[model samples]
Target: MKNWIKHIVLGLNYLKSKNLIHRDVKPQNMLVANNVIFKLCDFGICGTLKDSISSTHLGSMRYLPPERLGNICSYGTRSDMWALGMSLLEVSQGYLPLSSESIMSFMSHMKNDWQPDIPTTLSQQTRDLISILLERDVNQRPRYYNDILSMSSMTTLEQNPSEDERNLIENILKSLPIPTPE
Candidate 1:
């Protein structure tokens, strides 16, 4: 888990350093060649730092940030962080945090500031990182890649996690409150 997160943070930082925001980051865009190796792909909706907030809705609905849903808010790299948070949740749980019936329903949920219930099985450190990454205020999110990489939990993932680590991850996934279909 740590190693997987490390690679993801590294890739995210690389993209931020290049002033690029991968507007569409989802499980589908993340290709896992092996248990320990993964790659982030699909730059179709990527935008430069200088690009203005898009009026057109883009990216996968499940991964879309709250600010993108008709709010007057302007988004930046932190928007990617929101997507990263969702991606992490997907990787850890094998499913999206929010599985709405439609894009409009998803957007409505975001507008209402609805957030997924954090899994109790996650380590305090991991939960803390996710909380900050998924904060409603984009300005409060970690700006630089190093900020995220510097996280104690993320740094630990640079190497393979032990069996105990896998157990911890599984516990966390199990703790999540599964969303029921309406």
Candidate 2:
């Protein structure tokens, strides 16, 4: 999972360097090759970051950052980071972190400053990374991929988790109930 995340961050970093934002980041948009390497796709909704801001609200509603869904105006790379965090959380748990019975319900949840419940089965570093990534305040979230990579959680992960830990995570994932279509 960390390997996949690293590739996603690398992709985001490349986009950041070019002042681009992959507005629609989700599992559907992430293509995995050979069951290992991953690549972000679907650039149709990507937008350019102008002066560190983007006014357009074009992205999968479920993965959008709080600022994009609210009246906040400074949507930029941080929005993509939120989506990346959601994608990572979803991948780790085998389901979307937030589920809504209706669009209104989802909007309400987003409006209430709801934070997903990170599973305790995950390592503290993993949970810490996800928690900050999903922060409701865009200003508080790491603004750059380098900033994210610099986090102790991210840096520790880059060193590679032990094989036993990997096995334990794999087991935990296997134990999670598969989510049914809503």
lDDT of each residue in 8-37, candidate 2, tens digit only: 898988987898888888988886553355
TM-score of each: 0.78, 0.83
> Whose lDDT is greatest here?
2
Residue 20 deviation, candidate 1, in Å? 1.6
Candidate 2 local lDDT, residue 129: 83
Off by over 4 Å in 1: 51-57, 164-182
Best by TM-score: 2
Q: What lDDT tens digits, residue by residue, belong to model 1 across residues 46-65?
A: 77666634344567767767
Global lDDT of each model?
Answer: 0.70, 0.78
Model 2: ten consecutive residues of lowest lDDT: 159-168
* Candidate 1 displacement at residue 97 in angstroms: 2.5
Assess the local accuracy of residue 24 in candidate 1 as a C-alpha lDDT between 0 and 100. 85
Minimal lDDT window, size 10, model 1: 48-57
